[model samples]
Target chain A: MTTAAVTGIGVVAPNGLGVADYWSAVLRGQPAIGPIPDSTYPVRFAGQVVGFEPDRHLPGRLVPQTDRMTQFAIAAADWAVQDAKLDLSGFDPLDVGVVTAGTSGGFSFGQRELANLCHRGPEHVSAYMSFAWFYAVNSGQISIRHDLRGPTGVLVADQAGGLDALAQARRKVRQGTRLVLTGGLDCPLCPYSLTAQLAGGRLSDRDDPATAYLPFDVRAGGHVPGEGGAILVLEDRAQAGARGAAVYGEIAGYGATTDPHPDSGRPPNLRRAIELALADAGLHPADVAVVFADAAAVPELDQAEARALAEVFGPHGVPVTAPKTAIGRIYAGGGPLDVVAALLALRERVIPPTVNVARRTVDRAVDLVEAPRPLTGSAALVLARGVGGFNSALVVSTRDIVDR
Target chain B: MDAFTLAELIRIMRECAGEDDQVDLDGDVAEVDFAELGYDSLALLETAGRLAREWGVSLPEEELTQVRTPAGYVALVNRELAQSGAGG
Candidate 1:
């Protein structure tokens, strides 16, 4: 099958705006999560992306038409296209497509319009509200704005939907499309969003900042919520080669699996997902140098993830890291961000460390990397499991098709 | 009552439409329709709300459908302002 080369990346994480800043912040091991300040919501803290101005990246007309999340997507897509250095002078706009994963629509925009309705009347609501809160607005707006009108789609999977979206984009490229912008975006830090996240009982409610989300250790509570976007430019490997675009890495293989609800007592089949992705990449478990974990920090979820890693790697003790510990989980954006991190790791030949997760209170068989480690191989595994039992894994490496 | 100036009205219309570049601010309303400028019911309603808030007069939703041109829209708003002033 034809593979997709990730030529460029655009990130809007809580800790950083550009992909370069984000990766460096991840390596620095600083926590960006803090108290949400004023509001009376039981939820106290979240990872908020600061210093992002919609006017800075979006046109004046587009600034009002889009919500914060959509703005992030637009900026990210632009950054990726520029990074790829695409000479679209003779290219057909319809030849390209967009696929994005989102867990919820624009919460901040919806909340504002809803407030208008309550205070004034139905007529008081802004006309743009309809599109702003629609879950697929990112994909639609990105396609319309950039004129990438090929096969477009939006995935709303549990958190894993982001990875699933990339896998789908890869499929589109393999089928003959020349370019695909595949990524994930979400911002669930607002009041309504936080309330919903709290309802799921997966967010850290602790008042203490340092101990709120301790994944892989005994003190693991739950994940702190965040908002971010990661958009990638995925091109046909051959086309990318012909264009002489710099390759960060190619998505060699990806696999997805589902499990019954946690109440059903059916844990996720993550081990199977790992095996399938490696096999799809024509690689063995020994070939994978690092693993990016979901790291929900909830005891059961962390234990399950640790067991999956141990089962797959056996005695190899493959190093695992959950760099999201610094920025919290941005739902749909979390998985794609991990894929970017893995790609950068392959490029730098080093494994980034998991931060603020040195909780020694629990013992596990999995080898969690608390510090950065040098790696010998380029092949890496990135995993994401969502609240509703969606599990996804993808294999990425510096190796091109010729090497395979 | 002051007549609706084309510049201010056009600006308001573009604001209500949540668009500026697509709106042909210089287009002859007699020749061009709002539909051609990408105006829709939501924008119309929003425009109506803003107009009512600013001028203390409102247009019936049905009147919006009947008037497809910007000049028609201006005439309707002016007529409503007169009616509201007389009734008061």
Candidate 2:
């Protein structure tokens, strides 16, 4: 079977725009979490992408039809394709597929239409309403805009679904598709989505921006919501190498599990996901040099994650980091972004530190890297567990191609 | 409201249908079918909706369904505008 290799990464993140800017910000440990500029939201703080001009990156005519989430997906996809040097004009349209993970559809667009219906009557709603709010809009719009006719889909398992989307891409590549553009992007910064998030009560009500999303810290209140996402170009390893594409890393393995009943006091079934991923990669626990944690920052959830980490890798076993703490919880975007960070980490040989974490709160066996730690390993593990006990783990490593 | 010139209709078509194809507004385009113009029903729906909202000329859905060509769309819009007592 063919292996899936990551040839390119494009990120529209709260801390930065492109991969270079984002990686640099990660290395510098920059904070993008801040108070929501719009006072209409009850949740004060969030990680909103700053200074993103849609007209600059997207076609202006389609801008009104798409939600911010779709726009982010397009922008990041464009960058990823360009970075991979994949010529869309030269490739067979049927060979390129798109899969995206979306937590919510267009919040801002839906809010406007609903407002029109409530205040100005139903007739005033824009005709685009039929297309925007559906969860598949991200993938559909990307495929339509880019003319990619291969197997296109969207996964909606909230945050952890990001890795699941990439896994689907890997499956498609292994099944014979040549290229897949896949990731997660969700913009829930608008008023309606904020109200939805506030009702869920997972968002931090903290007024201070710096301390809003202090995952694994002693006084961790909760996670802050965030916007934007990351898109990756996954191609068949031989196809990528034949095209002279630069490989970032290989999607060696992926494992998904559910906690069954997370609120029933049973420990989250995260260790199983980790073990399964490592097993799939044909590597043991000792081979994983670093780990990207979920870092939900909800007190009980954080402790549970810590204990799970301890159960699998043992005391201070692997250098664990939670860089998503800086960007807040971007729902579906969170995990894939962490995967992008992990790929970059593997490439740079430097493990990025968790932002806003002053000191380790829960006592665990995992070695939490508070500073940027340099490492010498080819493999890294990225973990994510979401609402309703969705657990996802991905194993990414240098391409292990052997020729005799 | 003045009748929608070919230019205005092209702009509306381009705006509503997205940017993949350009709307030429030339005589050849004016005589062509919407399918030949790279437009679909969604674009027509949005264009007609925008006209109703902006020009107060709510073209009937039946009339919109009959609009196969650019000339057909323009004639229907002109007739609707005449009924709304606006466009000549």
Which number leads on TM-score?
2
Q: Which stretches of candidate 2 lie over 4 Å from their true place?
A: A399-404, B7-39, B65-71, B83-88
Clashing pairs in 1: none
Model 1, A257-336: lDDT tens digits are 88766687677788888888999899999899899988878887777788888888974379888888888888889999
lDDT for residue A146 in candidate 2, whole number 0-100: 87
Which lDDT tens digits does candidate 2 get at residues B26-85? 556787888766666777898888777767778889779878987788888888787779
Tell me how far the alpha carbon of residue A386 in candidate 2 is from the true structure, in angstroms, after superposition. Answer: 1.4
lDDT (C-alpha) at residue B58 in model 2: 87
TM-score of candidate 2 to 2 decimals = 0.93
lDDT score, candidate 2, position A291: 92
